[model samples]
Target: MSSEQLAIRIEGLSKHFSVYHSPLERLKHVVFPGRTKGFNDFRALNNVSLSVKRGETCAIVGQNGSGKSTLLQILCGTLRATEGTIEVNGRIAALLELGAGFNADFTGRENVYMNGAVLGLTRAQIDERFADIEAFAEIGDFMDQPVKTYSSGMYVRLAFSVAIHVDPQILIVDEALAVGDSRFQAKCLNRIKAMKAEGVTILFVSHDVGAVRTLCERALWLDKGNVRMLGDAFSVTAQYNQFLFEADNEAVPTSAPKQIEESIPQENSAEPPDAQQAMKLHRPINHWGSHVGSIIEAGIFNQQGERSSVYTAGEPLTVRIRFEPPDHADRNTMSVAFSMKDLRGTDLIVSTTWDQNPTGFAAGNGPLVAEFRLPNHLNAGDYLLAVALEDRSGVLPQYYEYIEGAHYFSSLTEKKQYGTFLAQVSQSVHA
Candidate 1:
């Protein structure tokens, strides 16, 4: 890509810090150049190179101490690189730390002006955006209070609000949103989505693999201060998750299942099944297991036993799953599980047959079917279904097949719903 198409670029980037044991050792090393060798070199990042295109959203993912923060610090100019060249071609707004640029003694209002000024905004520009920033923060009367008295959530709220309202060309965030409440986090994510639509370049660090897959088009995985993988978000996150599962000694699928072309049969229906819905059931975003068994077909059905993806609140819904069993496996030691998650990947409900039946049940060797029936209490929104099969015979439960994004559905409600799921309640007046 041309230089004009790139927002940030780095070549041979590296950062190293000198570790000193004590103050006396540091003083000794400074005073005696040749005799004292009291410090060791710790490399935080080594020969890292990446380029983020203009208007592209990219994510940085890894465990702690993996140089994620170090790289972000360098990109934001909070820390200098030990070696390499860097180029950033945009007006940058970064939320790298909590209250990073705020003065504890100053009120939130004053800090807003300071942060705006640091971002190359004029006093008039800050004035123009102050109302929107204050409204987004939702700190109410606390906006005029000293930041030192503010809670961690309040601090992050105000900081994130200011960062977004500044109209930055390139936005950088480093796990700052994790401190906010669920509602506020959802609000921030929506705003980020809006920003991405407006062609803003975004570089964020998040451990939430679901968020990475949903928000970013590409991902970079850092491991031990080196670039482990950098590619499409889905593929990179899949590999990363597999790596973690293996590191924990968990059972992961050894091989991909044979392609099954059969569609989920709709029972007692006059119309044929939808091809798109049928395709999604077999194409899970992330699939893993021991290959001992696999879900061949799955779908959501209505009361009439018709395959449907849309349902109304308080209606009967059933999740049907069919799987091929491993040869000679004892049916008494098997379990089936499924989870319902919202678009942001929050688990609204999780159920497993093993929870009720510890010993499992007896079944035949043919394809096994499991059906989960429940009232549709989920609030109005789109959702994804994940399914898993496990072997309980071992000391620890070993998953035979785990499929994420196995199916998609939506729930509609006429009553006002406040959260992920609706609750049954009755009101009584006593006066």
Candidate 2:
């Protein structure tokens, strides 16, 4: 059913768990008249109400202990809610937490068949799609080995492969999808979308905002066992990001900070141009992501896409930055900039997020491209293209560094020294 039609209805759902004490407390409850009725209680689900129509895909998102998992469990009937009611119509295949239904002792092939049966698939249906399942898993010969030996990634792939092959009308995926590599994650996302297209009801859950934005039409954000926001992905994600940034930047000390320094020395007697062309260059290849950190590949290009080693007193040049992130991050942003400097570092042309194209990027993937284009002309001798990326969110990077000279090209193009930038080069020469 689509969002327009009701597939499943949740009514005032709530689940609570009681903490248990020592054996003495357990005995006291059984015996005396004055049994103290007190123990720590946790309400995992609280007054959550929602409806899903047939052929609809919905997502439940929240931070740890925000009751998202509890809600999913209650919907699947694996765990009964303490308060509300859940109604399920057609058959459902759920991929919850890792190895939820499989026996560790069983081989991957065995668990696939066993889990398939649990989804009401007969031997024939599973056999028909067995090869498809195997290929989807990508686990290779390890399928014959007991699952206890499988890595977390291998387990998730196998489990997901079985869950999708059963052809259930409703699919519930918890955070289990995050266990696979990028390719497998994309594969699973596509299959879920396909199921939605075929009119199956799907529920997906993840803390990743990027994945949520790309996969779901709507989102439900839960905080402290309550729905914090329910709306479009972009709006909700922006709200969450704002909250995160505020928390992280609260204590950025003003004392002894890593200052941004501009050093450009100048005023030397004119000398003859070098016999060899004054140029700067570096070839960027597999130098994208590193365990330690990154460097930005910034360059100046003409309209025709040819790069010059040097520019005249004023000439046309556009700057492009190629960024690569480290292996992991909570949140990150990359900033590329250009400043007019002599041999010493002086900030003649400095612009950042506040001025031009202000953008942010997340880490955990491969190369990310950030570009900045400027209009033609500049009075330039030796200017440096400073390319740098910072989390700006104040999160310290585990493996982050600078690539000293990302790329350097001169703007020896002709111009009169009027404005600090090339914008006035033509007017200066004419005057």
Please report how far candidate 1 places residue 309 from its true position, in Å.
16
lDDT of 1 by residue, 1-431 (tens): 88999999988999998788888888998898767778888999999999999999999999889999999999989899999989999998988778688999999999999999999999999999999999999999998999999998999999999999999999999998998999999999999999999999999899988788679988888998999988777656766775676666554336546554343222222221222332344345455667623678777789999877789999988888888766555779899888887644456788888888878767766787889999998999877787878788888777667766677778899976687778788989998
Candidate 1: count of backbone clashes, pairs at least 3 residues apart or interchain: 2
Residue pairs in collision within model 1: 252-289, 253-289
The lDDT of each candidate is 0.82, 0.63
lDDT of 2 by residue, 1-431 (tens): 34346778887877888664776666666675356565557887788887777876677787788888888888787898889877788888889998688899999999988988887888898899899999989999999999999999999999888888888888889998787899888888888878878888888898886666566665677777887776555445545544454455456422221222211111122321111111222321011112213443456677777666666644445666555554444333545444443322234565544244334554457776655666645565555444444544434421133222334556554434655465642434553
- Tell me how candidate 2 scores on lDDT: 0.63
List TM-scores for all candidates, in order.
Answer: 0.71, 0.59
Give the Cα RMSD of candidate 1. Answer: 8.0
Q: CA shift at 32, candidate 2, in angstroms?
A: 7.9
Worst 10 residues of 1 by lDDT: 264-273
